[model samples]
Target: MDERELRNCFGKFPTGVTIVSWFDGSVQKGITVNSFTSVSLDPPLALVSIHKEAKACTGMKDKAFTINILSDEQESIAWQFAGSKQEILEIDWDNKGISPKINGSVAWMECKPWREYDAGDHVLFVGEIQELHFEDLEALTFYQGKMGSAKQLVK
Candidate 1:
């Protein structure tokens, strides 16, 4: 199987960008992900697929986490977490919650670990949402390996 080709094929679908943040002892850690999705409403469960090799994959196990859905203005933040940029950007975090959330996200969900599944190259983490927040701002999105705003893609 051609991994690059498979990734390209998967990239055809648009996905909302997110920063999955968690605490590693006293330090905060996060990773860029576009594979977040709501798994259930009655149980208020959400899921994030993280590559097995990512630090966040192990750091978040059995830990509280926040899925910070990026706003359209947060492209640089995504790059920073994705390890594509060298310069570290100063990010403001809302630390009042069980897990700190990135400020200025279009939406955020604070969650507790629920379950984990071993997928091929990634691990699927199911989180039970304990709290959430949202704003009426445009979301950052990924499609065809490019980043853009939800509004920009709709047009």
Candidate 2:
């Protein structure tokens, strides 16, 4: 039972990078998340897994939030929210939606908390997508512990 090896194995799979943004009463907060996924089409549900200690998840329970799908050019923005970089993010915001949308993102979804569950060291926040915005841009990705540049694959 090698946890490090297991994490490496999980990292081998490519995943899209996203920023989960929420307001914590006093200020806006965001965190870079790679565990976001679509759960259902009929109900328009999505999920984002956040570590129990994430600063962004401080006051997110039962609240509205935004999931910003980052473009490859937004790697720096991701790093900023990830707390892996020192530079503060100076991004634009769209206040038209139920939540604040990150401007210049490849896509975004305003969501409301639908459900939550415990998952070992993380909590899974299932959100019901209320509205969305998107563009045809390459998405930022991660694989094998490295940031990846992935272009949109047309179907």
Candidate 3:
């Protein structure tokens, strides 16, 4: 299989940028992900797919985590967590809860670990949403290997 070609094909679909954050003991950790989605409404479940080798993959198990949907203006924040060499950002994190919440995200979901499954190259982490919040703001998006702002298709 042409792995690069497959990734290119998958990249054609636009996805919202997100940061999956959790705490390892007293240290805060996060990873940039675009593969976040709601799984169920009755139980209020959410999912974030993390690469099997990602540091967060091991640290996030059995822990509370937050899925922070980035605002369009937060591209730098996304890059910072994605391991870019840019200057470290003075991130404002709300630590009153079990997990840290990135301030200024368009939306955020605080979740308790529900289950995890070994996917092909990623581990699917499903969480039960305990609390969620959102703000009215344009979202950051990724498509075709580039980052951009989402377009408003309707009022």
Candidate 4:
């Protein structure tokens, strides 16, 4: 299959949205990411995939990162980060201490790099969870190129 076909196939799988953040001097840089997952519960490890050509890819390679899991109310926050200009809104980042994170996200996982693997067009970054925080809220999800809500799973 071609690139478009491959991307479409991948899109079939819905995933949660996250903001992968890292510090660049006094500025904290991050981007919206959906290619993130838990790798091991025993070690509290997670992974995020970034495009090889993306600017954030290199920054993540050398520094610690944070995965801010968005809440359903954070759709605007997600859109801002994912937008072409990377326009972020005025958010309450005081809770983050040093790094920046969206206010009222469902959870935040602060991590340090464990390893990096080179995939075809993306680099898979494995991270060891150093810190984690959670709030009482529903998570946001993405499916087939659109934001979606999760319904109850009836047994």
| Cα-based lDDT at residue 133, candidate 3 | 91
Better of 1 and 3 by lDDT: 1
lDDT of 2 by residue, 1-155 (tens): 89999999998778899999876664667889999999999999999999998765656877899999999989888888888775665778776656778889999999999999999989999999999989998899888777758543221
Estimate, for each residue in 19-54, the C-alpha lDDT of model 4 and write its tens digit. 888778767788889999899997999999999988
Estimate TM-scores for all models.
0.94, 0.91, 0.94, 0.86
lDDT over C-alpha atoms for residue 86 of model 4 = 35
Better model by TM-score: candidate 2 vs candidate 4: 2
**Superior candidate under TM-score, 1 versus 2:** 1
Off by over 4 Å in 4: 85-88, 94-99, 151-155
| Inter-residue clash pairs, candidate 3 | none
- What's the true lDDT of residue 98 in model 3? 73
lDDT of 1 by residue, 1-155 (tens): 99999999998889999999988776778999999999999999999999999978888889999999999999999999999874767899888768989999999999999999999989999999999999999999998888889677745
Of models 1 and 4, which has the larger lDDT? Answer: 1
Better of 1 and 2 by lDDT: 1
The pairs that clash in candidate 1 are: none
- Residue 74 of model 1, lDDT score: 94
Clashes of each: 0, 0, 0, 0
- Candidate 3, residue 38: how far the Cα is off, in Å: 0.6
Candidates' RMSD to native: 1.4, 2.9, 2.3, 3.0
